[model samples]
Target: MTVWYPQIDTSKCSGCGECVIACPNHALAVVSARAVMVIPQQCSYCGVCEVICPTSAIELPFLICFASSDNNKDQVS
Candidate 1:
């Protein structure tokens, strides 16, 4: 199973609550004066939080998979 969520960089976070407020899914929150992922399961991976962070604290890591021709041939067999 693949899970997609925003990664909050606590060091860069300004605790401005921008990301938390901008989040449509309400997945992030301010905890201990830092941004934390609260409801990870509710996150829609829409990248809104990453874009709204003024301090560049939020990041959405994506897993890119490339398909090789050889691998495709093996699967077809």
Candidate 2:
């Protein structure tokens, strides 16, 4: 199985729900005035949520393979 990790910048985040709604896979949620990913497996890496985030709060840290344990991919938020 493969997975992508998304980092949320709470400082930049303005409590907007765009990312939560933009996530096509329903992998996002709002928790305690903050955004969270409840289902990362559902992420499709479409970059939809990242694009809609007005504060640039959501970011894809890097592309990762659990079996290899090598992380070189870095994407901007």
Candidate 3:
């Protein structure tokens, strides 16, 4: 299974810690002047970090899925 989490582009990151502070799940942290995903499992796939990033460094690569009425189960398209 593909895990969904925030991806921080170190090159674009400004070490502003905005994403870290904005994360409601406390999943991101600034380490050595770069933002890192400290707890991937805690991430809720919310776009707060990505939206809060000033440099557009953080990205959440979540798979877009839909539920099928027949099975009432999530289906990845």
Please count the clashing residue pairs in each candidate, in the order shown: 0, 0, 0
What lDDT is obtained when candidate 1 is compared to the true structure? 0.89
- The residue-by-residue lDDT of candidate 3 on 2-51, one tens digit each, is 77777899999999999999999998899999999999889988899999
- Model 2 agreement with the true structure over 12-50: per-residue lDDT tens digits: 888778999888889888887788888887877788878
Best by lDDT: 1
RMSD of 1: 3.1
**Candidate number achieving the greatest TM-score relative to the actual structure:** 1
| CA RMSD of all predictions | 3.1, 7.9, 2.8
Candidate 3 clashing pairs, residues 3+ apart or interchain: none
Winner on TM-score between 1 and 2 is 1
Worst 10 residues of 3 by lDDT: 68-77
**Clash list (residue pairs), candidate 1:** none
